[model samples]
Target: MISVKNLYHSYNKDGKYQVKDVSFEVANGEVFGFLGPSGAGKSTALNILTGLLPLQQGEVVVGGYDLKKVSNERFNKIGMSFEQSNVYSKLTAKENLDFYRKLFDVPTLDSHALLKLVGLEGKEHVKAGEFSKGMKHRLTFARSMINNPEMWFLDEPTTGLDPSIAADIKDIIKEKNKEGVTVFLTTHNMFIADELCDRVAFIVDGEIKLIDSPKNLKLQYGDKLVEVEYMEKGEVIKTTLSTVLPEDKRELQKIIEHHDIQTMHTKEATLEEIFIKVTGRGLV
Candidate 1:
């Protein structure tokens, strides 16, 4: 749904750079994540793709229209949610929804249901200024869906959300994906990326080090051991057996077959681990 190649951006002609030769793609109906730290050019890259900032070099295309030459008609194909809340604090939640109620030409959306879906059902009567950070985030999320575009650009989507609230936001994103919305998400939170992104690109200093599915990266960098845990004689016992080691398969089979296993799980390198190993830096 979105494509970028050899993308580069800089703030000034005196050699201050924000994005450099960055490239990636987000396919239709897929959730593609961009993981990077602050000042790492994530927002710069996002601006270029979203037609906010002029492209310094290379090409960007979104929703079958070249972003560099996109028309207003193409906007219906894209939607965006920014990090900061832009809602009017004096406006009630329903009033906020009512504000953008007709921004699109499609059938008017049922904002009451939308607010309920985001967990602000009864709170719609309250003005946004009185909301906590988490509440504001949820309301902001509801605003993003006002257009029902084909693609979404979410930056730090779960910022200010508690675990439960974050999960609710994640579910809303997943629900949008199920409805065939392509997502180009920019976030530093690897946990959220691991759970929601079909594939992620690790970017630093405006350059992309690697892009791949989390599961595949884990397989590529992790040992093939299944860690087992159990309790015996009031003490915890643990053991590791090669899940992919043919020679140890028999032993693993015997252990599972003969002993009381409390829990067993395969070991795999996390996206954060793989990113640090490749870039020698953390997102923070």
Candidate 2:
């Protein structure tokens, strides 16, 4: 549904690069994530796809239209939500969505229905200015669906919410993908990306460092071993396992047969740990 080749850009045409020789694709009905720390070109790349920023150095084809040649037509097929909440503060939630529904030139989906989809069902008529940060984020999420867009660009979608509220927004993104909407989501939050993105591309200093599914990357880069903690003869025993080795199996067999196993599980890398391994620090 989206394609880019050799993407390169600079905020100042003659200056340092914002994105350099980057390329990736989002398949039809797939959620693709672009992740990086601050100043990592995540937003720069997203802007190029959304037609908000011109691609001065590479080829971009979005929703089957070449970005340079057919932006006017393709713009309608794309939807966008940015880190900053973009809703009109003075308008009620229902009115905010109504305005965008007209702007997109589509028959409006019921406002309350969309509100309900984002967990704001009974608060449709509440003024957005009065809504809390998380609530405003939910309203913006509802507004993005106004056009029933073929593709969506979400940048730092869960920017200003507590854990529970952030999780609620992620759930909505999952639901959107299930309905077959192609999504190009950008964020610095690995935990969020790990949950919602089918595949993620990690970029740093205008270069892509890694691109893969969360599960595959974790398995490939993480330890393939189990660690067992148990008690034997009133003493705590901890054993490190190399799952592929015969000796580890013999040890585990003995533990299963003789000791009381309190906990036994394979060790795996978290997205945060993997990111640090790849780039040396957590997302800023």
Candidate 3:
């Protein structure tokens, strides 16, 4: 549903480019993530894809139309939810979605049903201005689905949300993907990306440093050792063993047989740790 090749964009002539030779593709029904820290050009890339910014260099096609030549009809197939909530403050939750439903000029789900999808069913009568931050975020997510868009663009969809709300949002995203909606998610939250994305691209300093499934990246960068923790004497003791060595297996067997085990698990690298290893910088 989306494709880009050698994409590049700059804010001003002779100024540094915000996106540099970035390239990727999002297949229909795929949950693709653009993972990066602040100042990593993630938003810049998303803006170009959504036609919010002019495409200055490289080709981008979203939903079968070239971005530079994207028409209103083509844009109607896309949905966007930004990190910052953009609902009308004075409008009630139902009123807000109703307005956008008309803007799309297409058959849409009932406003109440939309609200219910995002866990705002009974709060439909509440004015957005009176809603809490997390509630407003939920409303914004509902608004994005007003038109039942074929391609969804979510930027930090769960930012500032409590754990329960975040989980609800993630479940909604999964539900959409199950129905064949292509999702392009941009966020620095490694755990979310790992849980939801089919594949992820890691961007840093305006360049893509890595692109792979979360599981693959972890195995590629993780250590090949398992750590065993046990209670020895009056204190807890920990030891590392090579996962592939026969001697290490014997040592672990001895520990398991003689010690009161507390915990034993493989030492796997997290996405954040792998990001740091590849880019030599932490997420800001």
Would you estimate the TM-scores of all the predictions? Answer: 0.91, 0.93, 0.95
Q: Residue pairs in steric clash, candidate 3?
A: none
| Model 2 accuracy (lDDT, Cα) | 0.85
Q: How much is 248 displaced in model 2, in angstroms? A: 3.4
Clashing pairs in 2: none
**What is the TM-score (0 to 1) of candidate 2?**
0.93
Cα RMSD to native, each candidate? 2.2, 1.8, 1.5
| Whole-model alpha-carbon lDDT for candidate 3 | 0.91
lDDT digits (tens) for residues 1-284 of candidate 3: 89999999898846689999999988999999999998899999999999899999999999999987858887678899989998999999999998888887678879999888888989988999999999999999988888889999999999899999999999999999999999999999999999999999999988999899988998898767888999988899989998879999899889999999999989887888998998898887
Model-by-model lDDT, in order?
0.85, 0.85, 0.91
Error of 1 at 195 (Å): 1.5
Cα misplacement distance, residue 59 of candidate 1 (Å):
0.6
Question: Which residue runs does candidate 2 get wrong by more than 4 Å?
Answer: 236-239
lDDT of 3 at 185: 94
Q: What ranking emerges by TM-score with the best candidate at the front?
A: 3, 2, 1
Tens-digit lDDT track of model 2 for 1-284: 89888999998888689899998888999999998999999999999888889779888989898888854656567788878787889999999988877665545567778898888888888899999888888888777777778898998999777888787778878888899999998888888888988999989998898899999889877767888999978989988787778998888888889889989999887787788888776688
Model 3: lowest-lDDT 10 consecutive positions: 67-76
